[model samples]
Target: MSTPAEFPVTWAPRRTRAVLLPVCALLVVMFAVIAVALPANWQFNDRVLMVLSGVLFAAAGLMLARPRISADAEGVTVVNFVRSRRLAWAEIVGVNFRQGDPWASLDLADGTSLAVVGIQSGVGKAQAIADARALRDLVHRHGH
Candidate 1:
């Protein structure tokens, strides 16, 4: 007999720290340099604090650059930085891949377009195209 699976939905693959960490580091460094080079009295100024806070935020954002998807056996869950939404299989109207749009998109019955965020854009044009096609096929095969 086969064992039942554990989680119904899981986070899709994303770009690892090796890629995102450097970008974050660069920004942090730049901010730190500015913060340090400011007038001595400006260290306690609100503007300086604001800049430092922003730099800290950037680091946090970089550390959290993972794309996650969570759901039950019923549907898929997508949570990107700017948006968080869910789509049941029945709610998914269709899948489409085309030029200009980033990655694949799941067209919803309600008319909202949800971008698929798990794929890395830096993987090159060919990989992106293949990924888009693969996602489209998967959505078509299993999604409504």
Candidate 2:
């Protein structure tokens, strides 16, 4: 059986393009450079660079593709390649929408911050603001 408290509220990677598009662009640039600079017989070095580049490209893709939000009865988690964060429902004091901001974030009672990685950054300003406000309200209603 399920109760109101049992329902899970989850947010995930909504726009992977933020992570993927840059990595893809870098890969293209690197490929062009390698093709232009390397000689035909440099097989070993070419292979090594290709392998390294492939690893980095894959890493970036994975970071972008990875799920960024998971909220359950306990808390929510947000993952970023640079840094990941977890916040218990009790830990989050509030959520706010900022003017001219590029992304959504959680404002903790401790005066720290956590970006809402699942929100689309480039969406229409009004819609994004409204969504941010709605998320804040949800936290207020159901979180701490």
Candidate 3:
């Protein structure tokens, strides 16, 4: 059994953030250094382009850490790479994080399931399972 999570709690992929953010920072720095070290024949525009490319790469890396789940008294908000959805407690019917699954998912009242990427098993298995259980408890306590 998982311990109950407090209200207004937020869960994000800790390992993902820990790993990606630093790697992204390193890549960005490398890009900048490469831009500065480019041959003199390279135009200023070309160097700028390299720096811009690095920024874009960092942005993409940042997206990998974007998935998050925030729960409060009113409802739960799920944020994925490019989409964010808010669901009331009643809308969340169940939480599932079976073995081999990449992440947890929510069974919605609308007869559809929503992937909860914030609780990814591949990155941190134990934490993800605990979170899934906590979310299940929340659904049971608040979902009708």
Task: Name the lDDT of candidate 3.
Answer: 0.90
TM-score per candidate: 0.62, 0.66, 0.93
**Model 1 stretches astray by more than 4 angstroms:** 1-17, 41-43, 46-72, 120-122
Using lDDT as the measure, name the better of candidate 1 and candidate 2. Answer: 2
Q: Please report how far candidate 3 places residue 136 from its true position, in Å.
A: 0.4
lDDT per residue as tens, model 3, 1-144: 674546798888978899999988988999999999999999999999999999899999999979999999988999998899999999999999999999999999999999999989877788889899988888888987
Model 2 local distance difference test score: 0.65
Q: Which ten residues in a row have the lowest lDDT in candidate 3?
A: 1-10
Query: What tens digits encode model 1's per-residue C-alpha lDDT throughout 1-144?
Result: 121235464434445545676777777777777777777667467657757775887767664575655546566677665666777777777766576655556788888888766543544556555655554544565675
Residue 67, candidate 3: alpha-carbon lDDT: 96
Error of 3 at 29 (Å): 1.9
Candidate 2's error at 8, in angstroms?
A: 2.3
- lDDT ranking, high to low: 3, 2, 1
- Candidate 1 clashes between residue pairs 3 or more apart in a chain or in different chains: none
